[model samples]
Target: MKPAGSLALLALLLAGCSAGSGLTTGALLGDDKPAAPVNDAPARAFQVGTASARAVKCGFNFDPAKLKTNYLAYEKQQPSGQDTAKIERIYDVSFNGVAKAVAGEGEYCSETKTKTIKADLGRHLAGDYTPRVVPKEQEEGLFSGMGSGGSAPEYKAKHPMDNSD
Candidate 1:
């Protein structure tokens, strides 16, 4: 009778051969430069765990479509970058409107809310991707004054304000 260890080795060889039949035994002996990438987005760095922390840096560019709306009222208020203070004031008002909407006050309604997020989003995008205006002292101080350690506000609406601004 065949020895137990020899039988197990034979079974393992059969399994490897059957599983990898598509790979020619000869190709393993060749010296080839690696295969070229398939398309624009790379595949090597995109494993499951690593992908969560990785982002496709704005590698591709896009054009502004006609559908895109101009939400920054501050742009109309001051097109030229000459007046940072006035632009910042308009931004503050728009941000306050956003905060009120987020607070469930709905001071800025559906249409106004859309305009508000857009405006703030624009200012944030334009100012080196940072918020152009800091919120007022009252808004800044609201968090420390809150009863809790400022967990999520007690309530939320379809649109919430960045009360911290």
Candidate 2:
């Protein structure tokens, strides 16, 4: 075989080996250094897991084995560079909420819940996180208007006492 063809065969062999034998082409060809970390929104780390977790949670609530163990547990074991622990509490609380909603019952597993689940799951997967704004304690009343143009029309109201003029 030609040299280039031989090299191509070798890479394919290494890729296949990596899948089952844990022998990767990068390690084999001296490119074994770890990849650089990707900095992203904290929510990005959960983008994939949380999507699946929603579906799995339903099955997990009624039958834990059906969805294959817990989301945080299984996902953490994977080689994701992002920290899954940071979002553990979110998954925990959400899962507990699911369980509590159908405690001692199978309503969560019913067809009736499918529409709600689909709508929520669709929104969950459609990725745009807007944090709620909470006013600080020190900040007094009369908040700034939302969006760019903060030009709220000013109006002068005449008080009864002011009409003494």
Q: Which candidate is the best by lDDT?
A: 2
Can you give the lDDT of residue 69 in candidate 1? Answer: 18
Candidate 1 lDDT, 47-131, residue by residue in tens = 1101111111111122222111122332334434434433333333332333333444434234533443455434333431222
Candidate 2 global TM-score:
0.26
> What are the per-residue Cα lDDT tens digits for candidate 2 across 1-165?
454554454344323322244356874675635422222323332332333444554553333332223444444555655456544533343344333334555444455345434444554434322111111221222332223354543322221111011
Give the range where candidate 2 is weakest over 10 consecutive residues by summed lDDT: 156-165
Q: Distance (Å) between predicted and true CA of 10, model 2?
A: 54
In model 2, the runs with Cα more than 4 Å from the true position are 1-54, 57-87, 100-103, 109-112, 128-165
Per-candidate TM-scores read 0.20, 0.26
C-alpha positional error of residue 52 in candidate 2 after TM-score superposition, expressed in Å: 6.8
Question: Where is model 1 more than 4 Å wrong at Cα?
Answer: 1-81, 105-165
Tell me the TM-score of model 1.
Answer: 0.20
The lowest-lDDT stretch of 10 consecutive residues in candidate 1 is 40-49
